[model samples]
Target: MRILVTGCAGFIGYHLTLKLIENGHNVMGIDNLNDYYDVRLKLDRLKELGIDSDNALHQNKTVASDSFKGFKFVRMSIEDRENLPQLFDHNHFDVVCNLAAQAGVRYSLENPEAYVDSNIVGFLNILECCKNHNIEHLVYASSSSVYGMNKKIPFNTTDSVDHPISLYAASKKSNELMAHTYSHLYGIRTTGLRFFTVYGPWGRPDMAMFLFTEAILNHKPIKVFNHGKLERDFTYIDDIVQGITQIVENKHTAAYNSDNLYHLYNIGNSKSVKLLDFIEAIEDEIGLKASKEMMPMQPGDVEKTWADVSGLERDYNYRPNTPIKSGVKKFVAWYKTYYGNSNE
Candidate 1:
């Protein structure tokens, strides 16, 4: 299979690309490498796959490197329709794993336009390209945030997702709707994975895990929002990647009543963890007590999130095994090594 993985330099995308390449798939990866966080980390991930960090985006070129057999890196953005069509036509990709998006709930309030441009418009472009070409499967990253403010215990795929509290959540919900439209209208096979709070090594700096780790290491007071009374599924990166890999190859049939060649699943650890317990895990891992600063919950922040991944498990035999303690320990170890913090 030849796969087109957008946001290849990103946290999830980088891991997924490497997995696909390892599984003997021809993979073409693209990312603008925007400075959402540290570009150095993105470059370092690319280096692991043997991509040169020397201004490859400046030339708008695709480099065929031998670090991973049949892996090619292209510096491009999903918003660029002209180049995207050309790339699609040239490669005739068998599958597209769409992971590129402006992905922060709190940041979306400040920069709503970025979410609209990248999540909504850019996704439409992908739908158009997949429709034009004879692509086999299209897997996109949706979010558990889409179940905004719902008073549900475990968020399920069948729950009504019409009420979105944040712009980022709204954009993800819109992507799901748009993908369903593409599938219904053009017979395009699409699957949307609603990811829960994913955390592990090579995590995003904007996420809670990275922020808490950085603040703890820097001897700054870590803000404990909602009086340390929040819960998250906290799915590990490896588990999330495994769910994605299985779904990318498993195509859905167009059933009239229950299915339409379009499906959605919650990929997450079924159990939720409290904020205080999560922090304790980190504290235990780094062997440093964090100075706590109690604060009210920020806008677009949820009090708790639990995912119902029964659909994923039944369909794909998926089970997330990494407990919060083990996952946090792995992340803290990577953080210390990556930042050269001896204390951490």
Candidate 2:
């Protein structure tokens, strides 16, 4: 399969791209490489994929990977309405995994317009390209944040997401609506994965896994939101990638979802862990205790999140089995390797 992976430099996208290429699929990746987090991390991810850091950001110029044959990358935002269609036509991608978006809930409160531009506008462009080119499948990222204030133990796909509290959550809900419209009207096969708290090695700096690790390593006080009473379904990166891969490759039929053209699934560990317990896991792994700064919940923040991945398990045999203890160990090991040589 020849695939297009948007936001290829991102945490999830980078990992997914490697998995796809490893499975013998030809992949073309694209990212704006926005500085929402450290651009150096993005560059380093690209570097692992054999993309030269200096040349990975030239707009519209595609760079082929030196390490992997049939793997290529471009530095273009999916929101680029003009060139996206051209790229689609030129490449004729069989599947498009749209992971590119302005991610982050708290940031959405500060820059709501960025969410609109990247999540809404950029997604519209993707739908248009798929409809125009008759693309096979469009698998995109959604968030557990959409299940805002639901009071449900396991956040299921059928749960009402009409009351999203944050702009970021709203944007993801909007993406699902947009994809459904396209699927119903134009027969575009689409699947939306509502990801829970995804974390692991090469993870985003803004996420808890990276933040807690960095803070603990440097002996900085880690902010304990909600007075250390929050809970999350911390799905490891490998398990998340596995769910995605299975969905992308699985043969869909009318038996599943809305006539095989539209589907939504929760990709998560299906177990919620307390914030303090998670922090303990990090501390135990790093062998360094973090100074805690207890704080109230920020606006648009939820107390807990758990995923109902039963649908995914039944359909794709997806089982997220990475225990919290083991996952933290892996991330800690990678963090040491990655940040140890700071001046390299």
Candidate 3:
């Protein structure tokens, strides 16, 4: 299988690309390498896959090798219309994993325009390319945030996701709706994975795990939002990669009432952990006490998130198995080694 993995430099993207490459698939990776956090971190992720600084971001940059058996990476944003079409024209990809997006919910409030460009326009461009090229399957990242403020304990795919609280969440929900439209109109098989609070090695700095770890190691006070009452279904990176790989291989072909192929499911750790407990796991892993700064819930933040992955499990036997203790231990170990500080 020849696959195009967008956001290849990102945390989830990095792991997913590696998994695909290891499975004997030729992967063409793409990322804008934007300074959402540190571009250096993103570069380091790519560097791990044998993509160096010199040839990373050049347009049509293709580094082919035996490093990961079969993998090539390009540094380009999906928002670039011309570049996207050109890349699609050059490579005949059977599947496209659209993991790229403007991700943070709080960040969305600060920069809504970025969401529009990356999550909305960029996603549309990917759909267009996939449609034009007649790609077999299109798997894209959606989010649990799309179920914003819903009183539902376990968010489901059939729930009404019409009231997203943040621009980021709204953009992701819009992606699902838009994907369905494209599938209906152009006969593209599209699947949307609503990821829960994903965290692990090479995780995003904007996410809770990274921030709490960084602050705890530095002896700074970690902010406990919503007065430490928030709960999240923190899905580990390995589990996420496995679930996504299964979904990509098992492309959904069920036709909707409109006679189009579309499917959406929650990919998450079924159990939700309170925010304070999650921090405690990190503290235990790093063998440190975190200074606490209890704070009010920020805007567009949900008090709790739980995923009903029953549908995913029933359909594809997808079950996330990494407990918070184990996941946190792995992340802390990776953080220590990667940053040269065992306690960090």
What TM-score, over all chains together, does every model reach?
A: 0.96, 0.97, 0.96
- Model 2 Cα lDDT, one tens digit per residue, 1-344: 99999999999999999999999999999999999988999999999999999899788898999999979999998889999999998997989999999999999999999999999999999999999999989999999999999997888998999999999999999999999999999999899999999999999999999999989888789999999999999999999999999887876633345456788999999999999999999988887788999999999999999999998988789999999999999998899898892212
Show where candidate 2 strays beyond 4 Å: 252-258, 341-344
lDDT for residue 135 in candidate 3, whole number 0-100: 95
Native-to-model Cα distance after best TM-score fit, residue 288 in candidate 2, in Å: 1.8
For model 3, residues 166-211, the per-residue Cα lDDT tens digits are 9999999999999999988999988899999999999999899999
Report the candidate with higher TM-score, 1 versus 2: 2
Clashing pairs in 2: none
The residue ranges of model 3 lying beyond 4 angstroms of the native Cα positions read 251-260
Give one digit per residue, the lDDT tens place, for model 1 in 97-146: 99999889998988899999899989999999999998888999999999
Model 1, runs deviating above 4 Å: 251-259
Error at 223, model 2, angstroms = 0.3
Per-candidate Cα lDDT values, in order, are 0.89, 0.92, 0.89
Look at candidate 2 and tell me the lDDT of residue 296: 94
Which one wins by lDDT: 2 or 3? 2
